[model samples]
Every structure is written in C-alpha cells, then in structure tokens.
Target: MEQMNYSFSVCSSELDYDAYLAFLLENYAHIRLPYPFPVTLSFLASPLLMGEAAFLICNEDNQVIGAFSYIRGTGERQYEDRHIVQIQVACIAEEHRCTRLFLYALQYFTQYLAHGEEQVQEFRFFAPSDDSLRRLFSKISSLTASLETDSGPLDEYRASFSEWQSYASQFRQTALFNS
Candidate 1:
C-alpha cells in the first residue's frame, strides 16, 4: 500500500502554539482525554512557562493541523524500560488526518531528539478518554501497544527506534531495526 503524501512543517512559535491548542480543544472529543477539554491558552501557557518543547504540525496549505507536547523522563519513573515521553495533546485536523500528518510530526520529534537524548525508547498516551482515540491509533501497525480502558485495552503504540528494535527482536525476529 502506498502511503499518502503530505507536506508538513513543525513549528513552536506563539502563533502556531495558540493555533495548535485551539485545534486540540475543537477536536478533543475525537482524540479522547481524561478531563474536560482544557482552556487553550492556559493549558499551553502553563507548560510553556515550564520550558518544554511545544510542537505544531501544519499541512501543505500551511494550516496548523496537530499538536503534541512531550516531556522526557528517565528509566522506571513509571514503567520498566519505558522512558516517559508524555503526549499531552495530539490531534490531526479532521480533514487531513488520513494523510498521516500526526505521524509526520512524531517522526520529526524522534529525529529532533536523536542528536542529544537516547531518542525516546518508548511513548505513552495516558488519556482520560482513550477509548475514543484508540480507533485512529489502531490503523498504524507500529501503534499496537495499549492500556486497559473500561471497555478493554487502550492503544499505546511504539514511537521510538529502541522500542521498535526490541519488538522486532522479541516477536517478529526480523532484522529490521531503527537507529
């Protein structure tokens, strides 16, 4: 199957940040979250004040489509070998989602950290309303990991090279590896 091509850029400017947060609030029901959709500026401003990288995804037409906020944590802060790269907000524009724009932003983020950190061994999505979000994640083969929801298991797919390598070795026994 051919991957749909999309032109996108990652940004962190104030305008992009605000736009990204708005997109999240508009689409929060679809993405699934634990709490009521957050107030945009306050949600982002508090995190920005703490000094973490905020990422925005834009499409070919230069409209902001998605946003993901992540924070790095060392071994066993929560789970085994799973370094916490908390995904605070993640949403793809309703029209451009199938273009895999959110994945593009995630890919850029992984590479962006490669030069410094260990490139994030694993990522966790601990949403309050993950049930609504699992369907979209189920489409990506790499995103198979899940946590238990009231319904069943919520997806928690791999978004890092190391986790991919480990999964490949333990399960597929395929030589394919990242990094």
Candidate 2:
C-alpha cells in the first residue's frame, strides 16, 4: 500500500499568480461556482497579488490541489477591523473533496496559517448559490450561522473563530496521523 502526503504553505510570490489562477479556475468549475471566471478573477487576483493572506494546500509533488485566502477588507474594516477575518476564494479540487485532504485543508486553513501568529476574534465564510459550497459550509453547527440568506445571488455566513475551532477539532486525530 502507498501513502499520500499534503502540507500547507504561505503563498509568497506574485510570480506564481498564473499558476494559482489556473488552479482556482479548475476548482471553481469543479465546485460549480455560479460566477464567471473573469468575475471571480477580478476579486481573487487582488489577494493573490498581495502575496500574503493566501495559503496553498499542496501534494508531495508541490502541486496545489486546494487553496484558501483571507479577504483584505475595505475602508474601516481594512484599517480597524483587524480582528475580523473574512475568507473568500476557498476551493479544493473535486477529486480531493471527499478525501482526508478535505478535512486537513479545512482545518489548517481555518487556523489562518497565513496569519496564525496574529490575533483573530471572528471569522466569516461565504458560499455562493452553489450546491457544492452549501454542502461544504454545512459542516458548521446550525447555531453558528448568523445569516442564512438575503434573497440575493450569494449567501453569507458569519461565526466566531471559536466556532470554527470547534468544527475543525473533529478531524484532529485523523489530520495528525496524516500530517
């Protein structure tokens, strides 16, 4: 029998921006993201180009199979809401979605590895009107959902960072063994 390995690292260079875009485009399609590629690119590109606030989950070969990035905020939040974290452009390749890699990536990324040493008080996750995203977001406890829907095109969810910590705990033993 053979074993698989996955590890995470901070996205450190804008030089790899194209590679990240390709990975995101593929995963976006696999997850059936409702938005068009260009539209999503407009948003994700900013964070990717920043070279921080983004992390990649890669295989032993260093191929990025999953990624998650933090929202850079705007106006006041950009300046003062440092403790509040909003994550966007989170995606895992479909083939890896049902595997242990899913839990590993989810747990690690939620820890805000890119900002692991920083203070984080709250976390926000967003799921568009897509089936795959909705299912992924369901891992959180029902009570954690601050808002379900706004009759808009996209769905927004807000929960404390502690809530994410609770959800991520389930895979601790398995993730430990794998990592």
TM-score (C-alpha, index-matched) for candidate 1: 0.59
lDDT (0 to 1) per candidate: 0.53, 0.63
What lDDT tens digits, residue by residue, belong to model 1 across residues 1-179?
Answer: 75444443444577766776677667766665433334433444444664556666665566666666655553355323435565556667677665344545545555555544544556655443254455655443355454665444445554555653333334322111155
Q: For candidate 2, give the lDDT of residue 125.
A: 55
Candidate 2 lDDT score at position 101: 71
Candidate 1, position 170, lDDT? 40
lDDT by residue (tens digit), candidate 2, 129-162: 6566567666662324433343335766666777
RMSD of each: 6.8, 4.4
| Candidate 1 lDDT (Cα, 0 to 1) | 0.53
TM-score of each: 0.59, 0.73
Model 2, backbone clash pairs (residues 3+ apart or across chains), number: 0
Per-residue error for 108 in candidate 1, Å, reads 2.1
- TM-score of candidate 2 to 2 decimals: 0.73
